[model samples]
Target: MITLLQNGAYLLNNSEIIEANNEAEAILKSKGVVETKEEAKQNTMAYNILKEHNTSGNMEKLEIKFDKITSHDITFVGIIQTARASGMEKFPLPYVLTNCHNSLCAVGGTINEDDHMFGLTAAQKYGGVYVPLHQAVIHQFAREMLATCGGMILGSDSHTRYGSLGTMAIGEGGGELAKQLLNQTYDVNMPGIVAVYMEGTPSYGVGPQDVALAIIGAVFNNGYVKNKVMEFVGPGIKNLSAEFRIGVDVMTTETTCLSSIWKTDEKIKEFYDIHGRIGDYKEIAPGACSYYDGVIKVDLGAIKPMIAMPFHPSNAYPIADVKANLKDYLHECEERAKVSFGDKIEYSLMDKIIDGNLYVEQGIIAGCAGGTFENICDAADILKKSDGIGSDKFTLSIYPSSTPVQMELIKNGVYATLMEKGAVMKTAFCGPCFGAGDTPSNNAFSIRHVTRNFPNREGSKVQNGQIASVALMDAKSVAATAANKGFLAGADEMEGVDFTKPKYYFDKSIYETRVFDSKGVADSSAELVFGPNIKDWPSMTALTDDLMLKVVSEIHDPVTTTDELIPSGETSSYRSNPLGLAEFTLSRRDPEYVGRAKDVYAMEVERREGKAPAGELADAYDKVKKQFPDADAVNTALGSTIYAVKPGDGSAREQAASCQKVLGAWANIAQEYATKRYRSNMINWGMIPFLYEKENLPFELNDYIYIPGIRKAIEEKADKIKAYVVGDAMTEFEISIGELTDDERKIILAGCLINYNNTSK
Candidate 1:
């Protein structure tokens, strides 16, 4: 269904692809495109967008100022507090605060709504926009209001992609948004551009989720498009509807791509026009001779009804194949669960298999990936054609992306059709997508159209001995399975079913009547509201000359996600309070992580207060002093670190790194970072992102590692630093850090973005 190009490719007039080789240059030259690969690279849509937003003169390294920025309730409070700490007078650009993630207010008593009020007052005080609870999800509101042709938007959520609308939006950590609020630029190296060249139309039952799953399965593990911009350019663009393209675009985050954009056509223009923003419509396309670092060729027609099994979005398989080999797939899921959950919980998919068929307990169609107008309408049609969704363990829930979409569905009768078939229709809250709503029974299997199916994403706490699993499928397939009373069934299996394919009518009044828009005008007299649970960030000290770091937690997971670092769902209510939220750090992944990190943090606290280090810390300092006599307790900052095989694969939540910083972590030693956003978050939080490539390490859990002249090494831009594992004797090894810009190095020295901004002023 999807093929990744083995080498760089050239697109001639955005129609023909020529693989980069000796003959490719001649083919391009014959087409009257004699430009070199370097010159042609500038013709990509991503290159042009980056060039437009880049404040720096050079393209090799970019300093970008986004046109707008956005955040949800779970993230905005922390971002605003960081900016407030950094002396931000007003928002430097347009900002939208949406209360979708924490709208339920079902967890952490009064904390969720308290965050909503804080966001409202912050918007008023700082000059921004605020969307009330249940009005719209973060990405949906951005798509309807903020997305502009050829513009850029930055959000604090990882799925912040709006490429189908001709906008190059990026989802980053709150630190990056805080920088924008402080009139600072987002710095990074220019990303590679990959063309998603499509050629065929999707089959009858295959939806956007199927196409996205196929692409994700092809490229996610292979790193074919990791940290690169995916620019959709092909004849197949015209075959898909506007919303279908959007559904696929949002899932690009799962592929580990930096951002995404698509060739804008009349359909996209109509999309803007329908949303009452015709002025924002602008056609964008690749130049006649555009060069891409790589290309993903997608055959939409060949894409089957696919399902991504538990633990990852990349674990995709065709529904037909899975049904044919049910036991084998269930066994594979059991093996994978052992890798993720270990002996912590009793997990089994075998029990979910009733007789000869797999039966799921719940089906959810919600969030940015599933809760779109087209997906829901098609799902409603499928359910309308079926008999009733029987009253049993099986239950189905549907959530529209926004009030506007829900209103349109009401007008079109799609909403009533779904409800009549026993499918519960919810508001525009993002709870189901991130694990705050409709949690299934223990060990129950659920099929969702949500973004992720990682462990505990369904709100089951493994530490509490509660374990459930989620499998990802398209909305249509979920409806079909519901029609069959939760038995596994693909949409393609339902014959003679006609999708209504109703036209969407955008109701702008839904937002105008509820959303608070400041129009970039700030009220300096507005008093900021703070809830009892809301708390300021704890003060962090600057980086010291030498460092002593203890390895607290070591994870061997091939890829560690942000959820494991700091979980979502109920714990998200504590995001506004750094210390309160830090209490839950690694609580799910490693039950003992918090106690270990806090134990090391206490020693650092004692040293900062001019007290002598106690117990093991004192003994380690004496050993270090015996080797390097200049290494004193005053110069060497004691802290903790974690070793992960590959950390930071999902979510752009800064708390993943900030939690470590709050717990007195000074560095993270990993084989390699899974995403650029995670590494950036580490630097922004004043924690070192260390690279240790060798399989065998010089340090183990609770082992102390001393690195002398660490501050000087960063200041001098040293490539390699000698660190000795403090044991019976000093066992030395070399660890290196990735390239950092001058400002990044300064941020590390100043001990985080907040301190750097304050000291810079």
Candidate 2:
């Protein structure tokens, strides 16, 4: 059971939680507290680490300088290109670029390999580190090689979390990485700290995913810990191994939190020891009278094996409950489909029911979360002990996160066991986690241990009337389902299962032989290689005095993910080319979005070239001028916009916002943004992230809206922006942009990051 302490709490010598109703009074009355408030504040594991990294003089706002930054192939090319445009000579900090997301070069011909070559060349030229394809996934590599206690890391991937290893790691968009390459600080207001007090050991057959899913389900929808730092502390942490703790830590990204850190013990020290970096270990714990803005009591003993059903990681339920109420739960998914997909396609989960038992067509244990050494060993044991895994209409696959994990599995004979049971063994690739590989047949249902199961994340193009449902479970549960030949079953359903812990041996020779590390030495004379597919970013104009936006694609879904905004699988190969990747923008969610946005883009091009607009666009521009005398064609900048209830739900890929900006999109209207990284991406890419109520009746698709004096309003930090409907009366609504850093304001004013940097120089 997870309980919320909403009114804040104080940890008394790490023994009991005292509600901080009156801060001074509560501290004085508790005998467990030995330190003063200021002393306690500096004692937390997060506080010391944050203070060491913060460049800002005050703690109320932070300007953090991370020790290291990491990114995968899909993101590195764009980040390096941006930093290059910003006049960077060499990487000031150690940057590790791994090629895992685009390892599957099957779809895009030579473009995937082209990016890899560019990465290697850039590493040599700019003093960066590059890991070859299939060597290791991004997060796993960081954990095995780059993590250190009391040190902070920043990555361009959303799952860049290493707090379980006592490292404070944050996942952000490429813009943040670019800034770091230019020696800029990550600026943010001091975030609220949430204390997670865990106790009791979890029951057998329960994995870290179970505890994580429970915590996520409890706090995700309510925004209880949104953008806050979660500091885990308690005796129950002693019950978990380093692997188990890491598993839970990585999934914290699903809770929409900014970052996470855990209390360190011998287990974390042993983890660093195992990786041959014992000196990196440091003791991290909260002070005797440490205070927290909120508390989450996680009784690990009460958490059951969980499964998050289709469409989202937060649509979770216990495995036992799911089995008992299959039909009712399946109907709920169908109802969600009616709203998410509407009449675009037929999406059904009830049809998979067979003879009072629910079935899944595919089972995958892949990517950083499920591909760990311990999780795979347990899954292999479960698969080997089962009576039989019938191979009819059911398939299972496993992708180890790294070559080292694969070597250990092979040495321990676990690899042979899984392969003998009709499970396909694959290499270290992040494809299965983000829709590049293991794509199910149309309308088929699959269960996976991957990180996310958002719509179209399974590689199905919903625009082509193809759909596949994915439910998230632990590797153990996924193995049980495979053992039962696609029938849904919990790991505890079977008896006498042997889940013996295996010893993991670290092998550094694999990476040392194949990977390229410049060791802070750059060859300035090395020529940078770029393939034909790698194109430079187009020139962007500065923001004008007035703005005209045509509502291109309006989506009323509860949340729109990055995968839908700019797909991951095949389109990732084109990330180095901005205009090339922009073609796929909103391709899955809205099929005609590119064409509609491009029509407006063409109109903007004509206006900039001193040519009069023609066709329907010209008529719309004239109508806007006629309706709102406050707007004139000479001062107005034409662009496109999309309205969604909530957008930017998953992935830290900047392409979500860059794709829109490249397509001449000026703004996105939404009730709220899904994550801070997404909103920051939009702002960095020079697209206005406008917050509006979902119930508004102001704009429709293809309707033109004109905002007068937008440039002046932005410069003055106006709270509300007035807009007018092109052919009708003025429909002004109050909209807001919460806060903008000086750099962010400049980026928007200059149109894009590339332009801002160039204009500043």
Candidate 3:
């Protein structure tokens, strides 16, 4: 069980919680505590780590410079392209581009492989490191090689958390990394630190996923850790293994937290030693009476086998509870399907129920969260002990997080045991986690230990009339379910279970044999190869004096994931090409989004070419022009926009925003952004992020919303701007921005990160 404090709280060294309102009295009574709040603030584990990295003189406004950075194949191409456009000559620090996401290379013919080759050449030309396919997942490699005690790392992947190793790692948009690469600091106001206070030990059959899912299910919807650093510190830190801490830490991405750090110990030191980086270990712990902006108390002993039903990782429930209420839970999933996939096709999981027990067709333990050495070893043992794990209709696959982990699994006979038990083994690939590999049959159900189980994330294309559901479970339960012949079952229910971990041997030869290391020396003379599919980014116009945006899509979902905005799976191969990838923007969520946005985009093309708008676009422009007779068509920029209740819930992929940018999207109006990464992606892509709370909007889909003096408003740092929703007639509503750093304002005015950098020169 987990309990979230209603407000910020102070944490005593002995795992005692004190509410923020009583901080003064509690500190006074506490031993070895500072009298002032400022002094007490510096006592936190996060504070010590942050102060060491904070380059800005002011603690209130932090400007961070990361020690290292990383990216995967799905992202590195675009990031390199933007950096090249922004005048990047060479990588300033160690930059690793791991080709794990698109390792399959099944879609778009040679495009995927082209991206990989491009990454290799870029690393050679730009003084970076390159990890080949099946070498390692992004974060796992970072943990093994890049992470250092009391250091900071920035990665483009969303699940970049290495706090368990005493490193403060953050996942952000490529623009943030591009900034760091270009010798600019990551600017932000100091985020609040939330203490995840753990006590007691985990029960049998309970894995890190269970604890992580419990935490995510509890904090996700409420925005408890939104945009805040989650500093995990408690007496229970000693109870879990280093691998267990990592499993839980990786899933912190689902909590929508800014970043995470944990109190380090000998267990973490051993992890560094095992990875051949003993020098990276540094003892890290909070001081007595540390002040936290908030607190999350986790009693690990109460955690049980968990499952997150289709559509999201946050839609979690205990496996036992779900079995007892199968029909009701199944119906709940179906109802959720209505919101996520719409009524285009009938979706159901009730058919998967056989003999009053739920059944799944497939099981997967893959990617950063699931594909750990311990998780896979436990899974192999579970399957090895059981009489039969799978049948003709049921299949199980496991992917080790890194080549070193896989090498150890093979050395310890875990790999042989898994194969003997009918579980297929795969190389280190992130494919299954993001819909690139392990695609299921239509309407089939799969249970996975991947980071997310979002709709269509299982690799089925909903827009193409194929649908599948994925339920998240720990590797133990996934193995248990497999051993049950696809029947949903918890690992605890099985008898004579072995939880012992095998000794892991990390093989450096695996990487030294295959990985490309430029050794921080750029080969400037080497010619950069460009595939025909890897097209250059189209020139984006700067913010105009006046803006006319047609609301192309109106999504009323409580939260919209980035996957829905830009689908994963096959569409991901085209991520390198801006215009090619833009075609698939909002394809799954709103099929007509592309056509509608293009209709609006056409006018923008015309405006850029000094041509007149025609048809519906002209009609709408005429109506808006009547409001301001002096408004010239040449001065007013024509573009598209979308409105959603809450958008940007999943993935740190900047493509979610870049795809829209390529399609001429000028703004995104939302009740609130689901994550800071998505919102920052929008800003870096040079679009206005508008916050609106109007119950009755004067605009309908395809209706034009005009903002006059938009560029001037951005230049003046105006919080509220005058705007009109023009349907049949003009109606005014106030549109506003949440907050914009000075650099962010400049980026918007310059059109995007690339533009901003180029113009700054």
Candidate 4:
């Protein structure tokens, strides 16, 4: 149902496809044509919007007026702590903190709830919005209450997608939100625009998950939509509802897309009207002559029920194929499980496929993508007739996306129908997706309808030697699998049940009644509360003239997600405290990472205190003195740790970048960055987002690399950089940096984004 282009291809005259073999050739050949990636990458929709709202009077650095800022339980603590350290008083914008991820408070010694209570008190004092636990997930609350037409919102969650409702939403790290609270425009050079050409209606049983997975699989590996806006268009716009579009839109984050927008229609108008925000509806379409850097064509009808095997959303295949070729697919899953689960536990799927039936241990339909009204109603339709024919080994659970969606499901009897068939309904929570709730048994297998299936994300404590795994599936297929007594079955196999196209009845009364709405008022008298676990960001030093680094850890895996870097479950409680949270950096992937990083951090501390680095390194330091000869002029700065790899991907968590910064990491060396958000995270934390274009690196892990004239490079805005790797003798390498805004250059020079803002203030 999908076609992969072998090389970069250009959309000629908006209709034809002509391949562009290389970026350089494409750029030189298509100088004025604007028909390929090479021509369009330099100019993008984000850049255009930025130029129009250039309050800073600069083309590179932007100063924007956002309607609001938002964060969730996972991010609020960190953002608030960072802002407080930068001498924040009251919130300057409407900052909303919703309790959804850490609301469980079932673990971590009262730290999670303490963060929530702190949010409530801060809301009352600083005049911000606070949604209490069990109210709604962060993105749902944003969609229901905060999103408005033509407005811009900055959020800390990577899944902060609301373009379908007309608001241009960005999912960034907490540092970005902290910038907005400090009245700084989100600094970006603008993102390229990709026209997501949608055509053909999805056949019944092929839900939003099917369509979403299809698009993700097509683009993710090739980075087609990375750091770009996916503008949806074509005749297929009339085929789906707003919620269906939203289901697909939210999953775009997995593709590493910067943001997404869709052609608005009556369906969107109806959504706004139902929410009593008809005034928020506006017709937004691409200009008839609007140019796109790339075009992603999706044939919805050809989409099949897909399942993303454990560890990532991109490892997708047709459900029918897995069922038809059970043994081969089971072996593939087993091999994958071996890589993900390691020796923590022995997992086997081939044994579960008994008598040509794939027996799933558990099934879940939950989170932002799966818990919507349409998805649940369709699932209920499939399960309404099954009289628990599935074996006792199979269990099912459903979570409505929001309380309002729950109330509507009850009004429409969708919940009753689902519950009648041995399904447990859950509150609006993000736990199942992030390993907080619905933990599977040891060696158990679960099929879920959630955003990601990253390692240990299903609540498996891999570090402690326990492993349970999850495979992502659409809600309809999970229902079908459960109905068949754990025998894997695609939704297409379900012969007859009719699923009515239900109209969503949005009732904003719950939020209006319970949520604290500040309406953009800054209450200066509000005293911020601090939890015991909450702590300020550690002091960071400016870039050193010559740098030395120990790689600490090396991950040769094709992709290393942010979850694997710092983890998501218990470590979440320490997010407010940079050092405390940094302790978990690479804790799961590399058990020795923390101790190694701490050792390096101590060296930096000693140097910062005007003493020579202590221990065995003193001899090495003394030897280095002979090269520069002057104590003050040779090397002015010192940091002990750095992580280098092929790539850093997934999640907008600043912790991924901040953890390294706190651990005394001076820089990250990589072949390329997976997303702008990840790179921005590195920059905001005062770490060099360094790049080397060589097909191979001349260094290994723990190899100390030194960058000379680094501080001067920032002052001069030099794109070409020079560095030396510290070994028995110094080895030099060439590195390049993309263009940086003047403000960004200052931020790097001043140590970090917070330090930069503070110095200016």
> Rank order by TM-score, top first?
1, 3, 2, 4
Question: How good is model 2 by TM-score?
Answer: 0.97
Q: What tens-digit string does per-residue lDDT give for candidate 1 at 165-244?
A: 99999999999999999888999899989999999999979999999999999999989999999999999999999999
Write down the lDDT that model 2 would get.
Answer: 0.88
Assess candidate 4 and give its lDDT: 0.77
Residue 659, model 4: lDDT of 93
Model 1 regions more than 4 Å off? none
Model 1, C-alpha of 350: deviation from truth (Å): 0.9
Task: Please report, in order, the local distance difference test score of every candidate based on alpha carbons.
Answer: 0.92, 0.88, 0.88, 0.77
- The list of candidate 4 runs beyond 4 A from truth reads 3-63, 334-348, 389-391, 631-635
- Pitting candidate 2 against candidate 4, the one with the higher lDDT is 2
Write the number of the candidate with greater TM-score, choosing between 1 and 3: 1
Give the per-residue lDDT digits (tens) of candidate 3, residues 574-639. Answer: 988999999999888898999988877877887789888788777777788778777777888888
Candidate 4 per-residue C-alpha lDDT over 477-507 given as tens digits, one digit per residue, 9 for 90 to 100: 9998888878888899998978875777877
Number of the predicted model whose lDDT against the real structure is largest: 1
Give per-model TM-scores: 0.99, 0.97, 0.98, 0.92
| C-alpha lDDT of candidate 3 relative to the true structure | 0.88
Worst 10 residues of 2 by lDDT: 24-33
1-761: candidate 2 lDDT, tens digit per residue: 89998687778767678876766565556465566556666667788789999999888788999999999999999999999988999999999999999887776788889999999999999999999999999999999999998899999999999998889999999999998998888988888789889999988778877788889889989988888888999889999999999889999999989899999899888888888999999888887778888899999998888999988889989989998999999999888877767788877788789998998999999888999999999898888877556867789999999999999999999999998998899999998888889989888888998899888788678778888888899898899888888999877775688888898888889998999999989989988889889987777888999988999999888788999899888788899999999999988888899999999998898898888878886777667666565656667899999999889888999999999998999999898998999998998789999888747757789988878888888999888887777774656656677788878888899998878888988
Leading candidate by TM-score: 1
**Clashing residue pairs, backbone N/CA/C < 3 A, model 3:** 8-293
